[model samples]
Target: MSDKSAALFALTNSLQPVKRVWRQAATQIFANSGISMSLANLVVIVNRNAQGINQRDLAEEIGMNPGAMVRILDQGTEAEYLERRELSRDRRFKTICILPAGKKLADEIESSANKLRVQLMEDVSVEDIENATRVLRLLEARASNFLQEHIHEKK
Candidate 1:
């Protein structure tokens, strides 16, 4: 393989362990905090869109199926964490609103996540993190643009 190909291969191989460790740590933290990763994510998203977010939009944003989103929302509602309200003008559409309980849970989850993040990054230098974040953001943007262009070309 060429030097570029070899380097890329090594980078790709290295990413798996990093991703696995990060995910495992996050999962453990969430479990200990009495919430699943998906639920934590839902709480955070709902809390961020404080006014009210459409059910469909929320599902799409989280890359969840509409049915699954409904089930999750149902669970949250039952837990008194969220409320599904039908729009006054359009009964067909429902909005998901985070209740006070949900907000509190989201804050707790955020705090736990932040603590875990700090612990995980204890050995990493701030400069190294900044550079890595910059490179990752650039790669993400380029990859997104490439995908968009490719999709348009297919049309």
Candidate 2:
């Protein structure tokens, strides 16, 4: 590989371990706190969509299959944390809304995440964090764009 390609390859390869490390750490943290990672992420996303988000949109936002999203919502519904409501005139569509219990849980998740963020970046310089974040976002956007442009084309 050329120097440029080699650097890109190395950087992308290095991110896999970083992703695994973070996932492992997060799984442990969620376990210790008596929470499931999937549930936490799902609830947080629903909470963020304060106005209300329908099932299909919520599924897409979480990159979850609509069927799987229904299962997750079933759990939430059983817990009385969140509920699906008929937010539109169409009886076929329902929007996910955070109940009081769900909001409380979301708040706890956010608190835990904030604590984790503090510990994770305790000694990192602000400028360094900004630079790293910018680079990662750029790389992500570029990769997504490349896939969008090529994935639909006939090889």
Candidate 3:
């Protein structure tokens, strides 16, 4: 095989271990924090965007099934992690927003995650971190663009 093919294969192989480690760490943190991963993600999204965001739009952005999203929202409301209100423009649809409690939990968890990230990369140099961040951003942009193109091509 060519050098390019070999390098590509090596990069692909490297991603699996990184993904595995991240998943394990996240799962452990969530389990210990008494918060479900999806709930935590929802909190972050709502905290950033604020309450009264369209339920349908939120579900679509998160790639969640509408019914499943409704169930999650209902449970979150019961847990005092979120609130739902009917939109003035359309009474038929409800807007879901995260509560203060949820925001607190989300912020704490995100801080913990950041610390974990720092610990994980303790041995890596700042230069290495900068290069990695750039490479990852490029890869993400390319992937996002490819998906967009593929979607448009289908239409």
Q: 1-155 in candidate 1: lDDT tens per residue?
A: 99999986886677779877876777776686666677777888999898989999999888899898777887789888889999999999999999999999888877887899898789999999999888777877988899999999999
| Local distance difference test, candidate 1 | 0.85
Predictions in order: lDDT: 0.85, 0.83, 0.80
lDDT of 2 by residue, 24-140 (tens): 766665686565677777788889889778989988887789997787788888887788999658979999989888998888877877788789989999899999899899998
Off by over 4 Å in 2: 32-34, 151-155
Higher-scoring candidate on lDDT, 1 or 2:
1
By the lDDT metric, which is better: model 1 or model 3? 1
Note each model's CA RMSD in angstroms.
2.5, 2.3, 2.6
Please give, for residues 1-155, the per-residue lDDT of candidate 3 as tens digits: 99999986887678879887886787676687676777776776777776457788878777798789887787678889789888889899988887888788778877888888898889999999999888778877998999999999999
Clashing pairs in 3: none
Residue 61, candidate 1: Cα error in Å is 3.1
lDDT at residue 8 of model 1 (Cα atoms): 69
Ten consecutive residues with minimal summed lDDT in candidate 1?
29-38
Local lDDT at 104 for model 1:
94
Which regions in candidate 3 have their CA more than 4 angstroms from the true location?
13-17, 60-63
Q: Native-vs-model 3 lDDT?
A: 0.80
Q: Would you list the rank order by lDDT, best first? A: 1, 2, 3
